[model samples]
Target: MEYSTKETSEKYSNITSLWRANSSSSSVIDAETSPVHVGPQNSLKENDKIEKLFGQPEGVDFKQYSGYVTVDPIAGRALFYYFVESPQDSASKPLVLWLNGGPGCSSLGGGAFGELGPFRVNKDGTLHSNQFSWISEANIIFLESPAGVGFSYTNTSSDYNFSGDSTTARDSYTFLVNWLERFPEYKASDFYLTGESYAGHYVPQLAQLILVHNNHPKKTIISTINLKGLAIGNAYVDFESNMKGTTEYYWSHALISDELYNKIISTCNFSTPSSASKKCNAYLDQIDEEIGNIFLYNIYAPLCNNRSLSSTSISEVDPCLPSYIQSYFNVPEVQKAMHANVTNLPYPWESCNSTLNLSWKDRPLTVLPLLHQLMKSGLRIWLYSGDMDVVVPVTDTRYAIKKLKLPVKTAWHPWYLQGEVGGYVEEYENLTLLTIRGAGHFVPTYQPNRALAFFSHFLSGKLLPKE
Candidate 1:
C-alpha cells in the first residue's frame, strides 16, 4: 500500500538462502489443539457449491489457468480468487498463496508485479520481461483478498470502509476452502501461506487457521505443512519495531539529525508509544511537498536525477513508488492479463497517487492470536523483513515477533545469497525472521535474483547458508 492525500493505512526473495539463527529460541514440536473440519471433497458437489455461492468471473479470463471461483459466500459481496499451477503429471507440488498488502490495495500489485507474476515493469513505465520469476520455480497463486480490492468487488462499495486484519483473515480462509475445490491437487501438497506488509497478519493467521482446521476430524488435512517457512520484506509485524525501526533506519542513514533522533527516541516510547497519527501526519505533510518537487517517491531517484539514462545507470524507473501507477496500470498487456478495465475505475490501483478513500477501519491484529494457535498445533512459522522499507519496516516485524513469545530456536545471524550477505536471520520455536539486504517493501521488484535464490532454499525445506 502506498500513501496518498487520503487517510487509510498504507504500507521477498526466493530460494537462495536458508538462514539459521545464532541461538536456539525454542522447540518446534507441539501438540495439536484445534481440529480443522473440511467436509467431503466431491469435485462436482464442491464446484456446484462455490458457483452457487459466488458467481463466475465477471470479465476476467481463466482460459490460460484452471481453477474454480468462490464468491463472497460468507462476506457481504466479495469475490474470492485462487489460481493454480498444476503439475504437468499427476505428482503434487507444494502449494503457496501470495498476498500483497495495501489495506485497500490489491495483491496484483505485489503478488503479480513484485513477486511471482511472470512479468515486470521497465523504467519507461512499460511492461518488461521477468526471467527469474518465483512462479517458475514453484506452484504459486495470487489472490485479491477481502472485498473491494482489485477485481474482487463487493455489494458494499462502502465495504471499502469495513476492513480490519481479522476480517481479512477470516474472509481469506473462506476463500481458501472454496478455492481448494477449484484445484484439489493442492489439498494435500505441503501448504505454505505467505504475503508482505499488512500480510504480516495475513500469512500467520491463514497458516494458523489451516493448522487448526487440520487438527480437527472433519476439517481439512494438510501434509507436513512443509510449513517449511515464509519471508517478508520490510514487514509491519510489530508496531513498536515498525516505528522505531523507521526512525532508526533514517537516523542511521543520516536522514535525521542526532538531536532530532534523540528527541524522537526520548519522546516516543516505542514499547508503548502514543498514536503519532497527528505527528506522523505533520511529518508526511512536509515530505509530500518535497516528493512532488522532486517528482520522486523517495528522497533520491537516480533515474529522475540523471538528465540522461546510461546503459550502466540503474534503470531510472522506480517500480515501487505510486506516481508511476497510472501509466503502469494502463499498460495494454497488464490490463489484458489482469482483466482490468483501467478507464472505468474511479481511483488509481495504487493508493499513493490519490487519497485513501478505502477504510482500514476493518483491519485488526488477528494474526497474533492465530499464530499462537498454529504454534500449539506443531505448525512451522516464519516471518521476514526487507530492511529498506519505511512503511512496514524491519522494526515493526521484530515487534510483532516479540509478541509471539515463542522460545528462541536459533540466534540472529546474517543470511547470504550465493556467498554474498543477503540479510539477517533469527529463529524462535517454530518461527523464523529474516531480513533481505538492498530490498525494499517489494523485494522481487528490487532484487529478483535474490528473491529467486531465497525461495529456492525455502521450498527445498532447507536452511539458507550463513556467511
Candidate 2:
C-alpha cells in the first residue's frame, strides 16, 4: 500500500522490532541511529568488512549466495540473494532485476517476497514453496538498492537520507556496471528491469538510463535489453488516474455514494490544467488527502486481514512486512553463508535502517516527463495497475499512460493467468498497460500465480496469455 508522509514516518519509527527478531542479538540497533565507518578506500576493504560483519556458515544453505555488487563506482556493498539456481548455464536464460520502490525499500523485500522470490514464510515461521516462482523461467536478482538498505550499507553518513529518482537511477546504473565486473558472464543475457509502486518511476528512469548507455559508443553493448518490456502492478503514475481509480473502484464496489462520486467528478477533472483549475486541484487534493484514512484502508484491508494459517504472518504490527522477513534472514546459519561476523553490526538483517529513513522522499508527479523521454526514444515500456489497489489506483496509471500519446497497437483487453481473467492489458507502439485483478499494492505476495505468468510472457517477448 502507498504510504502517506505521516504513515511513512510512523512505519519508519517501528521498523526495529523486526530487526531484532531477524538479526543476531548483538547487532540490534535503533532505527534512527547511524554509524560512521572510516578507512577502507577500496572494494577489497568493503568486501572484508562484509566478511567481518556477518561471519561464516555451518553448511551450505540454499537461501544464500556470496558476491560483492556495487551500487556506486568506488564502493561496493555486499548482497545475498535467494532463489532456485538453474542447474545448467544457458545464455538464452534471461536475467531479470527486480526492484521494490520506496525511496527507502529493500528490493529483497518487495521483489523477493512480494513478487518473484521462490518461497513464502508461513505463519509458523517455516518456509513454504511457491509454485509460481519466476526463477523457474528467468534468473531473478534482488538488490538492496541505494545504500544502507538490507545488507547494502554505506560509509558516508551523508548518503544516509539521500534520495530522488536521478540519484537512484545513477546508482542503479553503477550497480549494473560493477556487478557485471564481479560476475562477467551474465552481462549480455536478455535483461528486464521490473518493479512495482514507486518503481513506476524507478524502473522507467533506470531503463531509460540503461538504454542511453547501451546506445552509446561503449564496447559492451547490452544486446537485447529484452528490455523486451517492463510491467508494474498497481502502479502510481498520473495523479488523476490514480485518484480517480480509487474513487471509481470504491463506487463500483459500493464503498462510496453516487452523490459523492458525482461531486468528485463534476468538481474535479484532473486530466488537464485548463480543465483542472486551481479550484479543482484543491478539491482533488482534499479528496486524495482523506482517502488514505478511510476508503483506501478498506480497499487494502484484505492484504493485512489474511491472518490465515495458510499464509505467511510477517506481522500485523509492522506495516513494513519485510522487517519480519529480515528477522528470518538474521539466522546464525544465514549470516555465516554471507561471510559476516555478526558481532560488528548493531542489528540483524534490517528490512530498513532508520538512518536510511532520512533518505526517503515523497515522489512528485513527474512520471509523464520520464514516460515522454522513453517513448520519444522508441523504448518498449509498460505501465500497469492492480484493479483493487486503492493506493496507487488504476486511474492514476491510466492517466499517466495517456500522457505518452504513443500510437495505439492494441486497445484495452483482459490479460489472464492460468484460465482466469487476472487483469487487463493494453498495447501502444512501445508500451503495454496491464491491470491485475484482486491485487493490492504488493501484487506478487498477494497474487503470485498471476504475477509470475505476467513476467513469463514479458521475458519471453510474446503476447500475453488468453483469458
Candidate 3:
C-alpha cells in the first residue's frame, strides 16, 4: 500500500497493544530527583558512553554513546539516542543527525545499525563493521525521537495519543539543545540533518524550527544550532504529487496495466484522496492484488524467506536483517550496554512503532513550503530518491520538486562514482535533486558505497562527480 493511504486507514482502525503480557506499570522520572542531572555534563557523558556493546567487534577504534535526553521533564518524556564519533579525526569531521521515518521508527535500529552507522548486526546477534559506513565522513547521531518510539518513552500514557508533527519537532529541538550541552565539543561543528522515508517531514520540520529559534530576537534559549543543511531520501513531501507519481510509476514500470492506469487517473481525485470513490478504492485494491506479497519498498529485490544467519552476507542486502536487529536489541545485555530501556518498557524494542505510525497527528499535506523557506534562508537542501523504491518512488520526488518551480542552476546529468554512472543529479537555485542508481526505499542500506560517495560530497559542499 502507498505510505499515505496505509497510514490514513490504520489511523481509524482499532488500536491493539503491542506491549508484553507481563508489562509493569508506567514509570515516572522526576526531573529534579533524577541523578543524571545532579552531576556535571562530563559525568553525564561518561554515564552514557558505551565502553562496548554486548557483541561488539574487537579493535573498534571509535567511541559510541547511547542514552536518553529528557525532552519533557514534566511529562517524563525522553528521546533515546545512539551516537558514533568518526573513526579518525572526529575533531575535524562535521556532525550529522540521521533519522528514520516510520513516523515512529527507531533511528538507532533503522539508520544506525540497519543502514549507515559504523556497524551492522549479524544474524547470530554479533556486530560487524559496515565498510561504507557514513561515520568515515562525520560523527553520526541516530535519534529515536518523540517518545513512544524504540526506547524513547513517555510516562503520561496520553502523550502517545497526542504525538504529532509539531510536538515531534519541538521535542527533537529540545533534544538537540540538551544533547549539545552534554557534548559541547561538537556544538560548533557544521551540522547537517539527514533521514529517509517519513523523515522527509521530520528533517525539514525540525530544520525550520531550528532556523526560527536561531532568529529569535530575545535569544533566551541556548546559543544557536549550527545547522548547515539537510538531505532526505525517498521522502514523502507532497500528497497530490505523490499519488499522481505512484500511479504513473506503476504503469510506466509495467506493474499495472494501461487500462487500470487510465481509469485511476480519470476517476481518482488525488487532491482529495480521502474522498476516493468506490471505483477508485476498488482499482487501488486491484493494484495491491496484482502486486502480491513482493516487498513494495524494493519491488525487484528478493524477500526474506527465512530469518537464518546462513543466508546473510555482509556485502549483500539481507532482507531479513531487520529481524536480526530486532533480536539483537531485545537481548537484555544489549539494553544494559546501550543504556536503553531504562524503565524496562513493557514492550520489546521494535524498529517501527505501529501505534505512532497509525496515530501520527499532524502531518501536513505538503512540506514544500518549509523547503522553500529553508532555501530562502540560505540552507543547503537536497531531495534524493532511490530508483528502485516504489513506495516513495523517484517519480514522486520529481513531481514534488517540479512544484517548487525553481530555475535550474545546472542542467540534469548523470553523476559518476569510481568511473561508473552512480545516478543522476540536477541543481536548482537553492536545492539539489539526486537519484541513487539501483537503490530502494532505504538508499544507504541498498547502495551503501554510492550513498557514502554522495554523502561525502554533500558534507564537503562539493558537487557530485560528473565524470
Candidate 4:
C-alpha cells in the first residue's frame, strides 16, 4: 500500500527535520558540500582499487574497485559500491550504475555478484567468470544504497528509522557526485541507470535528481551528471497496475481459481490496498495459500535444492545463488579485500535487510509521472520484464505502461537472439517495453544471453533483431 496521504507527508517532514537537525553538526565532504569542479586524482582512486578479490579467478584483465562513498557526513552515512571496468577498451565504455531494489537489498550481492557482474561466487566461496557479464558492454557500478544496506551504514543509529524513497535518491545522487570526484576520468563518459525489482523507484528517482542538478542555474560540470538513459527489469512501477495485473496474471496462468479471482476483483481496491477490508484480506490470504510453496519470483523455477552448492552453468539459473552470495560476503577476508565493513556493522551481511524493508516510510502510488518527466527531458527509457516472474509480472508492467497513454511508435513483435525468439517488444514514443521469454525476475540470472543481447542493443542504440 502507498503512503502518499497528507498524514504520511507530515510524518515524512517531521522525520526529515529530525534527520537534518541531528546531522547538522558533522563536517563531512559529500555531494552537497563538494566543490563545483572536480579533477581526476590518482590517490583516492588508487586507494579504492581492488588489486584482487580473495577468491577471484586468475587471468582477470579488468580493474575492479570497491569502497564507501560518504553521502552524509553529519550522520556518518555512506553507501558502498563495487565498480568493474570493461575488460577491453575500459576508457571508451559508458558507465552504468546498477541498483537492486528491495528498498533495502544489496546491489553488490544482487547485481554485482548474483547477476551481471564479472564474477559469480561458488559454493566454496571461489569466484568464476560470468561469460555473459554486462561488463563487456559498459563499466558497471553496483551500489548498496540507503546507508543501512550491505556494508553501507550511518554512524547515527536512528537514521535507519527515517529511510525512504526521497532520502535514498538524495544519498545516491550525492554518492555519484563524490564518486565522480574519486574517479574523475569518467566525468565525461555517458552514464546510464539500470536496476531491477524495487529499483523501479531508485533508477527513475535518481535520474530525475540528476536532471534537476544538470539544469540548476549555478550548476558546475562536476555537479552536472552526464545521465543519458535508464532501464529497469520487472520493475514495480505502479501499485494499482501491479495489483490488478498480479491477480489477473494469477488467474490467467491458472495459479488461482476463477472463484477466488472474482472474489479478489470484487472485494479489493487496488489503488488503496492499505484500506483493504478484512474479507478482502482473507481472500488475499486464500490466494497466497492457493499459490502454494512455489518460488513466486519465478513460479516455474525449482526451489533451491542444494543451498550448499552453486550452479556453474551460464545458461542455467541458480535458485541458491543468494545463499552463496551471503556466505561469500560475510567472509572477513572478502570484506577486507573489498574495503567494506570498515565500521564493523553489528549485523551480519544479508542479501535483503528485512528490518529496513519493513521500515520504508514513503512509497508513492506510482512513479509514472517521474518517468514522464524524464521522457520529456529526452532520456532513453526502457522497461523490460521476465515473463516467468510473478513478483512484477509482464502483464503488470504492460498495464502500468498503458497508464502512461503514450503513442505507440512500434507495434509488438518478436525480437530474436541467436536465431531464436528472445522475446517480444513494443516501442512507444519515448519508452520501449520488452520481455524475456523464459527468464524470471532476475533476467540476467535466468536468461543471460538474452539479457546481454538487449543490454548491448541499449548501449549501442540499435534495434533488436526483428528476425
Clashes in each model (backbone N, CA, C under 3 Å)? 61, 23, 0, 0
- For every candidate, C-alpha RMSD to the true structure in Å: 8.8, 9.3, 6.6, 6.9
Residue-level error in angstroms, candidate 2, position 18: 27
Which 10 successive residues of model 4 have the least lDDT summed? 1-10
Give the winner by TM-score: 2 or 4: 4
Which number leads on lDDT? Answer: 4
lDDT of 4 at 321: 70
lDDT of 1 by residue, 305-359 (tens): 3344422112223523333443565555544444444235554454332222233
**Candidate 4 to truth, TM:** 0.91
- Deviation (Å) of 9 in candidate 1: 12
Clashing pairs in 3: none
Candidate 4 C-alpha lDDT tens digits along 1-467: 11111122122111112122211211111224334323344587788999899899889999999988888776788889999999999899999999998778888888898888999888778988999999999999999988888899999999988798877888888889889888888989999999997888888888877877787767656546788899999988777777788778889999999999999889887665556677877777686568766776777988776443457877766667777788989999999999989988998887777667667776666788888878899899999998988777898899999999999989999999889999999999989999999998888888989999999998777669999
Question: Residue 79 error for model 2, in Å?
Answer: 6.8
TM-scores, one per candidate: 0.72, 0.74, 0.91, 0.91
List the candidates ranked by lDDT, beginning with the highest. 4, 3, 2, 1
Those runs of model 3 whose alpha carbons end farther than 4 Å from true positions after fitting are: 1-42, 307-312
Off by over 4 Å in 1: 1-68, 73-76, 80-91, 123-127, 216-229, 271-358, 365-370, 399-407
